[model samples]
Target chain A: MLLKDTISAALEGLKRSRMRSMLTTLGIVIGVGSVVLMVSIGASFERFIVDQVESFSGDTFEIHAKGVQDIGKDVLSITFGDLEAIRGLTTVKNIAPAIFLTDRAKYGREEIAPMILGTTKEIFYNWSMKIDEGRLLSDEDDKGAKSVVVLGSQAAEDLFQNENPLGKRITIGARKFTVVGILETMGSPLTAELDSMVYVPFLVAKAIKGRTTYIDYIALQSINGDNELTRQDIVSLLRQRHNIDNPEDDIDKDDFYARSMEQAMEIIETVTMSITLFLGLIASISLLVGGVGIMNIMLVSVTERTKEIGLRKAVGARRRDILIQFLLEAIVLTLIGGIVGVIGAISFGYLISLIASKFLGDLTYALSVQAIILPLVTAVAIGLIFGIYPARKAAALQPIEAMGYE
Target chain B: MPENDAPLIETKNLQKSYFNEELETPVLFNIDLTIKKNEFVAIMGPSGSGKSTLMHILGFLDHHTGGEYLFQGQLAHEMDEDTLSRIRATRVSFVFQAFNLLPRASVEQNVMLPLIYHPTIPESERAERVAKAIETVGLTHRKNNLSNQLSGGEKQRTAIARALVTEPDIIFADEPTGNLDSVSGIQVMSALQELNEAGHTIILVTHEKSTAEHAERIIELFDGRITKDTTEFKTRKAKEEDSLQK
Candidate 1:
């Protein structure tokens, strides 16, 4: 028989049982939909986190002391002398020694817990922070260790409540500090809570901690993304200054780490990829069940159309022709399902992206072309594989025996 | 009728039996028959006389358990399923008692079914043959109507047209008018008779005496065996001999 004839006959058979065909297709739709949605959300999640980290800063490195809480740990702390030494390197654009102190601030009747960071004025160029009003801590404030603070936008609002905080003295742990500047608003990503911080000169913050010798870390910006070269220089200089014997050892072995923004981005990517792969496989199980569902329906179709099969055979349809006709029907059934599933998944992914972007800081969901193509191909394959037994059953029916069936 | 040319269909000691592991029920036993070219014969018997079974065996729709069956002297009993299907497609066609036109297909589509499997004709020629077949059956006005949408007579005629579309040499119509009213019955019988007069050999299986009377010859089956055979219409070979004498 001609391929066109087989297809038309299959179409007629399906049209006679529209409800059953649609129900069988629904299984594949759910299968493909969940897979696409999971992958799209995963890709969008990776993009969101990467974008979030990039928003923090760019082309920078940080030197931090190793954790002493763990066993066999060395308490290698960075010093201000090392920061000054690295600042003169040709690849270094700017450097700032940052120290954090837990402190409470008071303004008239209001009290707010604020994270206080101590750094130089060049810290503004290394981070996203900018002065909205008044002046940042000057070099004079750092040299003299003056009790002056720059309040983060949220912290300023909480302490002063719309009042101009510049030059207002706020007591922090028995020390009165004049607020010299209010930093611009910056919503945090997966990093530091910058909106609720207060900035001070490095010397002043260390003096408040009563540990003027040890600083938390020095933040360094590289000129034209010469970050790796700058990291090598800092490691050599720090190891020499602290007099660690092994120059061949890695920084982590010396209980120190020079971390970059790129490393954090890679960690986020690995995490999202693993999660999406796991979820996508779990979603494919439903398609397997859908294939069996198609087989069951096709078996019933063969039983119901036995008489028609008899008539076709009597009119000279070969067994192969009958098999091809029945097989084409099942394949056509699932192909329709596959197409509908891809459309549903893509549109659903778009909805998820819209909602996530609105509520979750620019998170997006997106369907990849593979997400659509793979499932559609799987649906076709499922039909081809599962359709065989029923098609063979129909083809093997004897014309006289089949005709005798009511 | 007897002729010097080879018979269209011949079966010697044809037998059919239904069997499983426990039992064997014989349906037709040692039936010997021959049908000549352009012969219109009806095999008539009461219910359960194995008339339909004999028709099935003769039509190549069933395999004979014991027989030497031949189609134009080709050994049909030795033919494989593929060869039998090829023969069925080109040399033989059937119009069942139930008017087995595909219920969903229109009259035109039902008529074109045999041609769908007709390999000898070019693809472009099939539609023209189908049109002529439907027009010959006087169903051109209702060609677009579905099979189930037609009356019983129309359905039977459509089946005839479907059988005629490939222009098979032989037509085996198993009770073609069995389900129709008397007027519709005569109409369907006349259609088969018209095809017979056009030099197409037709074999019919029926129990109705009035339906059997339309055939040029009758073969009576009783208890799975032929009891009598008679011819009412004058054999064409006899008329040709008379013409030659003139």
Candidate 2:
């Protein structure tokens, strides 16, 4: 028989019970919809995270004491002496020590507790922190331990409330500090921590807090973007300064850890991809259930149309004709559901992107090529997998018995 | 070679049995029959007499366990499934007692079904043949109505049109008027008589002696055996006046 005739016959049979056919295809629609939804959302989220990770400065590295008992209180693993020693290395282009203290800043009854970062003037250049209004801290500010502060843009906004806080005096724990500058907004994951903090000269903060032994971490920029060599030199120098002998390249035994930002970007990519795969796997279970549903409905259809099958056979239809007819019916069912599901998922993805862009800047939820091809291929394969048994049963029926069946 | 005088259907020592595991219950026993072209024959029997089984075998809808069956001088019993289906598509057709039309299809589509599977029929000629077949059965006025929407006689007439669309050499009809009223049954019997007069061979099966009188020859079956075969009788003419008298 011609393929056109077989397709029309299959469609005619399905049209006989339109409501049953549509209800049978609903399971496939739900299955493909969720699968597409998960895939599109997962892809968009990964892209969003990767874009955030790429925004940070790639030429910088950070070093901190590993497994310290007390993070900021009297730990001798990293000290001011170690910082001087690291600055002595020729590969060290620029470096600054950072100490964090949480304190309330009062400006005429507008009191807010913001994290205060204590570092040198070189930190502004080493970390590539831009200035929005006034000047950053200078060499004189650090060397003379002047009582000066630079407010982050978010911190300035909160403290002054649309007023110019550039040269204004704010009290930090009863000591008056002059705000010399406002740093530009850094939009990244790091923004949550760095954008809301106040900056001060390293020596002034040390003098006020009476910190003599340890700092939290050391931030440095590598010369010529050669972070690997700088990272190795820093690790060795720290091991030697802390007086650890022959640690045999076991980082677990080292007193301090040094890592470049490039390595952190790779770790983030791997973790996000894994999360996407895990979510996609969970969504595919519904597709399996949908396949089983197709099988069940197809079996019922075969039983209900036994007399019809016999009539067609008696009218000169071959066995394979019957098989092809029933199989095409199943494929048509799944193909319709797949198309509806793809449209639904794309609309839902666009809706999610619109909602997400409000909190995250310009997150475009795009449907990847895999999102389109995978669900459709899976739907077709499900039809074939679940369609063959019932079709074979229908084809193998004896015409004499079937025609006379009560 | 085309034999001008050969019988259209010939069956010798035809036997049929139903097997359940290791047990066999015989249904037809050593039946010998020969039917020529353009003959209207009726096989009459009560229930369990295997008349339906004989018609199924002769129509190629079934197989005989032990028989040598031939159609137009070719061994039909030894033919493969594809060959049997090919012959069925081109040279043979059937009408069931239930008037087994596709319930959801229009009368025109129901008549056009057999031509869809004909291997040699050109696509352009299908509509003409379907219209001609429906005209033959006098169903041209109800061509577009769904089969389920038609009366019982109309449905039977549609089945006859479907059988005629292929211009088959022979048509087997089992209990054609079993489901119709007397008036409708007369209409259907008259339609079959018209087809037989137009040189189409028809094999009809019915248990009613009155219905069997409409055929030119009658073969009576008793307990899986042919009890009598007689052709020397006056064929009854089915008329609408008889139905009106009742």
Candidate 3:
């Protein structure tokens, strides 16, 4: 039989049973749609983490005391001397030692719990802090200041409430510090709350809190052309200076728990990507089920058209001809469903990104070639696998018996 | 006629049997028959006399149990399934009592079915042949009607057209007029007679005496055996000879 005529016949057969065809294809649509949607969401989450990582310069690293005491033991402490030792290293550009304490700040009758940081003048530059009002503390302020502070935007709003915060004294944990600046709002970090914080000079905080030797953490900047060597040099020097036992062992094991922003972001991306693919495969089960559904329908179709098969055979249609015709019909049905599902997935992804951008201010979903090609190739492969049995069944039918079937 | 000339069909000891292991029933015993080119022959038998079984074997729709069956002097059993299909498609045609036109197909498409199976013919020529076949069967006016929409006589005529479209060496009719009224039956028989007179070989299986009388030769079957094979002179030839004598 002519190819055109066979295709027309198959199409006419489908047209005669419109409802059944639609119901059969519905399985494929749902299966493909679920896979695409899951993959797109996973990709979007990866992009979100990457953007957050790039917000910080890729070159900076953090330093902390190794093996901080377990719950039953006393906290392992690092000293201000260790920070100075790291800063004095040959490859070091600058270092910012930080002390973090949570305290309740009071303005008349209102009080709020805010994270307060005590650091040197270089904290502003190293941490990307912008002063929106008044001036940041200078080196001289750190040396001679009686009491001075900088409040984050959220802290200022909570404490001063419509009043000028600069020059206003807020009492924190039995100390009064005059606010010199209100820092602009920076977005939240993966680990820290950025909005609710205060900054004060390191010496003043140490004096007021009666803790002069210990600092919580340090951020290190390596000079150009020596970044990786500097990172290694600082880590080794800190390990030696702090008397860290088995320093090489700790470094090999990643048990020190220190990370650059870029590394943290990379870890987040890898984990999210793994989850995405895992969910995608889970959703692909339905796609396989859809393929089975197609096979089932094709088998039923072969049975239903047995007489037609016999007639064609009687009229000299070869087994190969019958096989090709049925296979083509199966492929056509699945490809059509695959295309519909892909369009639906892309459209849904776009709509979700729009809504997320509007509400959360961080929407960047995109469709990848894998998202499109995987489902299409999967559908075609499914067509071939599922089409074989029905095509063979049609080809194998004996002409006389088939013609005699009611 | 020279014996060397190709007969449309020939059979030697063509035996077909059905074995029920439990009942041991045999449907067809040893039988022998031959049909010449351009000769119209009718086989008459009661139900279960194995006439239909013989038709099936001759039509190449079934295999013989134990005998040599030949078409145009080629061994039938030696051909593969594809070759047998080709022969059924291009060399021999069938007209069924049920008017076994595909109910889904239009009259024109039904007539074109045999040609669709003809691999050597191009599509355009097939269409031309279909049109000519339909015109010959006088169904040109109703070519677009579905087979179910056609009358009993018209359905049988469409089957004849389908058989005629391939220009086969022989046409086999299994009770072609069995389902028609007397008027429709006469119409169908005359069509077969006309086709035979035009040098197309036809083999018919019928139980009706009047239907078998239309053929020049009648072969009677009983218990899977050819009990009688007789030829009668054409009535028109007898009348013409009488007029010449007067």
lDDT, each prediction = 0.83, 0.85, 0.79
TM-score of each: 0.84, 0.89, 0.84
Task: After the best TM-score superposition of candidate 3, give how far the Cα of residue B44 lies from its true spot, in angstroms.
Answer: 3.6
Candidate number with the higher TM-score (1 or 2): 2
Give me the candidate number with maximum lDDT: 2
Off by over 4 Å in 2: A58-60, A66-96, A120-129, A138-144, A187-190, A206-213, A220-257, B1-6, B233-246
Off by over 4 Å in 1: A56-97, A120-148, A160-171, A178-184, A188-192, A212-259, B1-6, B77-81, B120-123, B227-246
lDDT of 1: 0.83
Estimate, for each residue in A257-276, the C-alpha lDDT of model 2 and write its tens digit. Answer: 77777777777778877877
Off by over 4 Å in 3: A65-85, A88-94, A107-110, A120-153, A156-171, A177-192, A201-214, A221-255, B1-5, B18-26, B99-105, B108-117, B146-148, B182-200, B231-246
* Chain B vs. true chain B: TM-score per candidate: 0.91, 0.93, 0.92
Question: Comparing to the true complex, what docking class would candidate 3 get?
Answer: acceptable
Per-residue error for A258 in candidate 1, Å, reads 5.2
The alpha-carbon lDDT assigned to residue B93 of candidate 2 equals 91
Q: Write the per-residue lDDT of candidate 2 for residues B75-142, one digit (tens) a residue.
A: 87678888878888988898889998887899999999988889889989999999999998899999
